[model samples]
Target: MLRVENLSKNWKEFRLKEVSFKVGSGEYFIILGPSGAGKTLLLETIAGIFKPDLGRIFLEGRDITNEPPERRGIAYIPQNYGLFMHMTAYENIAFGLKLRKFQREKIREEVEKIAGILEISDLLGRNVKKLSGGEQQRVAIARALAVKPKILLLDEPFSNLDPNLKGRLMREMKNWRKELEFTAIHVTHSFEESIVLGDRVGILINGEMKQVGEIREVFSKPENEDVAKFLGHENILEGVADGRSLNINGIRIELPQKACGKIRIVIPPESILISKNPLVTSARNNFRAIIHGIEELGAIIKLKLSIGENLLSAYLTKASFVDMNLSEGEEVFISFKATSIHIFE
Candidate 1:
């Protein structure tokens, strides 16, 4: 329901250069990028808070590039949960409707409905300052939704929330959007969030749109090295492809059938299997690699392995590590299925 074309904007230190993308009606589109990547600038530009140097923005086939923020029928929920501390949750949510000269009864009805949907009905009478971070965030979201905007632009709405609260909020958002058929563009730095919340994800880097596609497709086959690495492909190794096979540091691996070229192989650390011996299995690739180091990261253990001249990382459960009696300076065989190897040309 929204489209941006040739959008360009410049700031003191960062600039958006002809970035473009589209979101369909009722679709959950996420703009994912690292910090200082101009994600907020782009969102603000679309919201008409910052005028673009050059470009056009369309909503539902109508041009809104120069439309005023209020007239554009869009709601923006910023990262800081912008709520007026002086106002109570009910008043904050009713403010927009009041500004539009909506009737008092209508405003109350809308506010109550939104608060119920966001599960913040009891907190409505409390002042915004007294609410916890998650409560205030929910209030902000309720306020934004009360207006019934055509599109909702959320800039890291879950950034400040605890992991458990974030998960609950995400599920609530998904259910609310599905029921209301709301079109949303959420910007986030968390890959997990994008995968869970976005119907399609657009990866932005340095103001440039790198890749845009379904979550699984993008994760499975990233367009380039940067995108692959960004999506949690931590095990990167230089490899040469000969036909349908790849050779990396004296290890030969059969790949999915594709065009042949020198490529960099990206395998998720979790995909690598640690075995005590060369077990004949369905895995097409196996190699004997030395355990260079082992580090404990929370519940999982990261094993640094050296295969010939290549260094690779493997992630295993703590239980598995203990069961295998893994230690540094030990010999172990690494194995992975053919389909797990992602070859980027």
Candidate 2:
């Protein structure tokens, strides 16, 4: 288990301010944020590459704030894979064991074991520079695992990988984590990676940790407007709240809680149901909107709808779009439950 308490690090114009979180044993905790959010800096600080200006870091209840990188039982793998280009895959993996003065037989055994698990046994004798992106990634991970660190720190591990390879490697890493039972802190800007690999996630922005919780909880109910926006809530609207209702563009939407004053509401595009005909349903919000724009994104279809003076986004499957014979500038019915809305001040 790893715990960071009020860790603050200042570098140049960016400052990691009062960031705190905990990663449990065998838990894949993800630090989710956009580019330049100091994700790598935080990981480096934890790995002892940079000392924090203030606060403490504890590993299994032992304070390691002042410990050197080599003294701490943590493995850090950078975005570049950080393998020795001149060395073969086998040598790269065995480098750590060699530096630690492991016996020749033990180094060979560890390197082979990790390579087999990562499915890179065939490329072990090949030079790292000659391997593909995914292969090099496996080699880097093998090197990290060969040391058997208590905790693993991964900084944008799959950033350089292509889409297909990214998905495959994510799945492979999940299985490997289960088999290895290693506690890991993975930092990434990609939502798909966080959703697939993280048991829980910490939202970081502008060098601050805004929220941290289970993946579903954090995504479904973001702590603030910034967090909500980062989670891909494309339909953010400001409205006046009067008791249990909201008034936006002369349209009244029922709310799950009674709130007053101005507030912001986030309606997930997937939550809005679109139909050519109005159906008798329990949803409190229903309106006739014009489809002003339609975008085809692979298997998903995004529709920009106009209701009165307000615009909203809705997503549908490609099959459903074709089934309805929908087109741009056409009129349609949109409905959503009051409870599906996320409201914040």
Top candidate, metric lDDT? 2
lDDT of 1: 0.88
Tens-place lDDT digits, model 1, residues 153-271: 99999999999999998988889887777889999999889989999998888888788888788877788888877776778877778888888767777887664667887877888
Q: Which stretch of 10 consecutive residues in model 1 shows the poorest summed lDDT?
A: 253-262
Error of 1 at 294 (Å): 1.7
TM-score of each: 0.91, 0.95
* Candidate models: Cα lDDT each: 0.88, 0.93
Worst 10 residues of 2 by lDDT: 8-17
